[model samples]
Target chain A: MSQYIPRKLTRLPADYCFPAEGDVAAYLFSEEAVIAVEVALVTQRPLLVAGPPGCGKSRLAETVAAVLQWNFLHQTITSRSRVEQLTVDVDHLRRLNDAQRAARPEARTKARALERDEEYYNPGIFWWAFNPTSASRRGLPANVGRPRVAARCGGVVRRPDNQPQHTVLLIDEIDKAEPDLPNDLLEPLDRRSFGLPDGRTLTADPAQELLTIITTNRERELPQAFLRRCVSLLLREPERDGLIAIARVHEPKVAPELIERIADRMVELRQQRVDSGQRSPGTSEFLDAVRTCHDLAISVDSEKWQQVERATLLKPMVAQDEPSRRP
Target chain B: MSPAGGRRGEIHLGELISALAGLDCDDAAQAATIAACLGFGLRAPDLAATGAATPAIYDHNRALPPPAARRSAIPHPPGLALPASSPAVEALPAQIVPSQLASVGVLPSTDSSAAPAWLVAGYQRLASERSSPPRQTLFPERAARGVLTAALARWRPGDAGADLDLDALVRCIVRRRLPQCLPRLPSMTLDNGCQLLLDYSESMVPWWEDLRELARQVSGVLGAERTSIFDFAASPAGARRWRADREAIETWQPEPGRPILVATDFGIRGEPPCDLRGSGWPAFVDRCAARDCPLLILIPWSRFFWPKNLGLHPQLVHWHPATSAALLRRQRGLGHRTAR
Candidate 1:
């Protein structure tokens, strides 16, 4: 209630573990990231995150959600993603089916049920995100029989308690979406509300708390107008020491020397990738290399280590095409 | 998406300034400080403002410029069920047509050695999310983009001047060196970045809108971060842009290896001082040449109105509206005789 007790944090703690979410590894929010989150909360704007893939952009949202212990909802935007799908969609097919079925005499009792609009309503992420209680029941007020919660896709993160309220939302990989998608999000984000199909507006509760985190991989350029409205964050990939620290968190049992060596190797690979105009190795690749070496007992100096590096770090298109250089 | 949900289209930043003065900083420290200041001043507004002040919340249904219902296009062919995910791109072949496969000469292939060109191009179109639009510029848009990217006709690389050096690859193998990893072979890129200089002086009044549009188009081509913009009146030596890339009103100078695009008419309207022959204009071209920055001057006035006796220098193109690609090609020395 009332923006859910504004969480004004000075520094974002490193190596933060999510209680409700599973095995997210680490989210090392820098000082700027900390301020960005705070600014989003204060300004009531979406945090637009641009970064290399696997740079922990989504995790920032999840971590913030877990910290706030608010209801977490996420949508991974793809080429197929639509601005409408985030807010609400009517189950027209089901409604049509119900309409067809109402013609039968045996189904007379259920025929009148068609009059109930809730039967054909399906809430999108924004609905469940802003106010779950009404979204779960298709905008019907409470105390109506048990609310028919639509089966959620993978978007739902940690569920809230007996009282589920709106909070943090993660709109991941927005760049994968068409340019218009960001432009379309201007109002829903700005107003903290969107329009419903039934002509009713779904405004955030005066008490509702919401934090929107939108990530982009620079796959497509976002419109200038869209970028102007957001609290933008550019998350650069971590440095060598940062990578080593991340590796330790993801795989602690791996020997420090092995981690250091793999981290060093990843750094070298990244430089080559950048120079070659290829996608550079990210934290995810570094952790995978460290894990592979630790699991297989492949020493960095061992000839087999080259195979490991090729598999994890140097595995983009050009390198992938090369006949295995394994001796 | 609600069809009649809320007001739509672009919302200017000035109107939302109090809401959008967020950090545009690349430096983390600077961003943090900016955010802290915003947070501190967060409560200052409510405490200082009166009840007569307009509320920040943009209520859709009520007044405060009653949010106009956004007009949505009706899915046509009446009963045809189109997928909601249909992106805002042009009509394209949803599946690979065999007819497209044999058009070898028309459709050139990708530079990737891994696969055939047509297959890669088809696969890429199917995979990538995109939208489109372009304006008549000094450069030409391709039947498929990538055919003509350089702004000039006879182009020279300003920053990026490399192609895949197979020799470097061969040297690594010939030397029997399997050192850490494979040697890098950078693909050719046209430029390091694009820096645009605008003429905001009185002479440019008629073309002020054109100047702004040019900046947007260039930013649309090279990313906003890679594109820097400065506005000047009499000369570019004092042209100024926000210095966030490396702080405020920074002076214009040649960014080594970065191409410079200046949209100006030399303030030639009723003026002798602003002519291209003498004003700091020729000196500016020298600076760009010295820094290896290919300078392209886009003069709104056609070639006839262009000042006479101007010494030879940076390429100047007539920035005429609706200047066809064919004409631009001929001017750029890519005429029919040189075809192939």
Candidate 2:
């Protein structure tokens, strides 16, 4: 039997700003990238994206999640993350106890034993999504009882409620996580089902059609094994038009002239710094300058120009002195 | 050299100029007086009494005194007049402050057969093999970005020249030194340790499934387990999780013979804490551990940390196929622009 997932659910909260259609394909490699991702989704391949810092690597995942209306799961990596930390094990015993108390008060003793077993072998978030029972069909047979209820960090998923047929997993900054951690996902990610502890396998049969999107800042060399599994797409520093669109999104009140000035300056600064000594300002720095100028009501006069220029240029130059001097 | 040494040299030239210009007075007298004061090199030549003068003549008929032929503290004896027609050296630019010319000095000429003394000393260092690179002239934006990125790109092994923060470090390293030519690959390995864990499997599904039930159980268990267990979940769970991850707290070691971590490198200790140590562990360890196999899960924990600590991300250490191509394209464009 097929599971029912709520289709075309509105993802963005009411107050959130949706990306304007005109600017949708403006970012570098954005149009082709979206096409690449769409193809990956159709073919069921995890999308791997690589780029420099100012390049919008993370946004691809966010955009895919936004466009597809899939529930987005974002996990940022750190030096401290472990396996269980990323995909948590569920607390099955407590779930059974609560289920027992609410429904079958007469079978309290038997329910208690089940509760202990559940506690002993609780599944994590990975197990819940990987398990078939978690995504049980809409109409269950009478003997099965109400479908299993799984707990999660975001919210609980009632097995009886519509199972999320499509999920967009965004692994932002995958380069930061432990080198070995990425390879672990190969088997379960490929098989679309993971085995749980109680000899009960969690299978998303027909399966959880996951659109996995992994982003890396290209800070280090990724293992070849991980790179081979996914369709890799790269995001570069946006071109003039793309940058203008990005600036518009962030600073709605920004004047066209100011946006162009900032974009031009940013591109020039990045290019020169890289040429001078590999020292380019990031998008954040440019925006911060724009906001600062906006806040203080300052214009780029010769003196005040130094203020913005110093923030963007001189300081980074001084900081990067030795490197620039190198052969 | 003594600070007063230049004054000594100046006094001799001052007297000579005064004598040749025929403006003999206190300035000229003072040179003699100072010579007297310093003792030696003070005797005046008898030719001064006859007032014989010649306009900077260079032929053998009136050859000038070789500045090096005599070293009587000053280049010439105090009373002798220099040739009247000697060319006056125009005063150096006032803009060149003394401090700015701190390296000013004289060098002995190797080709003394033809070269002048001043030229020998002035051009020595400038012509030396080891002068610093010329200052770059870049547009402001280019200076800000390209120069900065290029500065970051220069980092080599053992150059710990910074105490930069995360943002500064990434701006310095990743953005600056990024290879201009990214490789053209059918596929490219991400050249970095910065990773992301996109858990697409719906975090909310587990949340909706069990939060109420878990909360109810916790509420009930509070009486039996006491508040301490729940407190454990609250207080140090994050920290404990971090520590446990490092300590391999969850690894199930059934017996003594099983190797937990394989490769051992004590030398890797001083590097960033995240640097992987036991890379070649047995596969049995993977089976035994409750955690996912370390190979498959990619998390971007190293983002700012690598740039801050190591200056460059580990992934970009080698050239991946596509990155090499991208870098090549960038470099080619740069080369063309430069050629023009």
Say which candidate scores most in DockQ. Answer: 1
| Residue runs of model 2 more than 4 Å from their true location after superposition | A1-29, A88-117, A120-150, A155-164, A308-327, B1-340
Docking class of 2: incorrect
Tell me the whole-model lDDT of each prediction, alpha carbons only.
0.61, 0.40
Q: What is the C-alpha RMSD of each candidate to the true structure, in Å?
A: 29.0, 34.3
Tens-digit lDDT string for candidate 2 (B13-105): 443333323322244434343233212243421110111111111112333334455446756658879677778889887695456546558
Error of 1 at B69 (Å): 67
Tell me the tens digit of each residue's lDDT in model 1 across B1-340: 1212344333233323433343334554443344432333332111111111111111122323333687779745667786776577788869975664554576666667777788767663443555545554433322111212235322333312122234654675469653343333322232344677888888788887677666655554443444667877777877865433111235676776677778888866744434456678777878888887767778877776676544555667777645554655565455532201
Q: What CAPRI class is candidate 1?
A: incorrect
Candidate 1 Cα misplacement greater than 4 A, ranges: A1-23, A142-166, A316-327, B1-340
How much is B253 displaced in model 1, in angstroms? 40
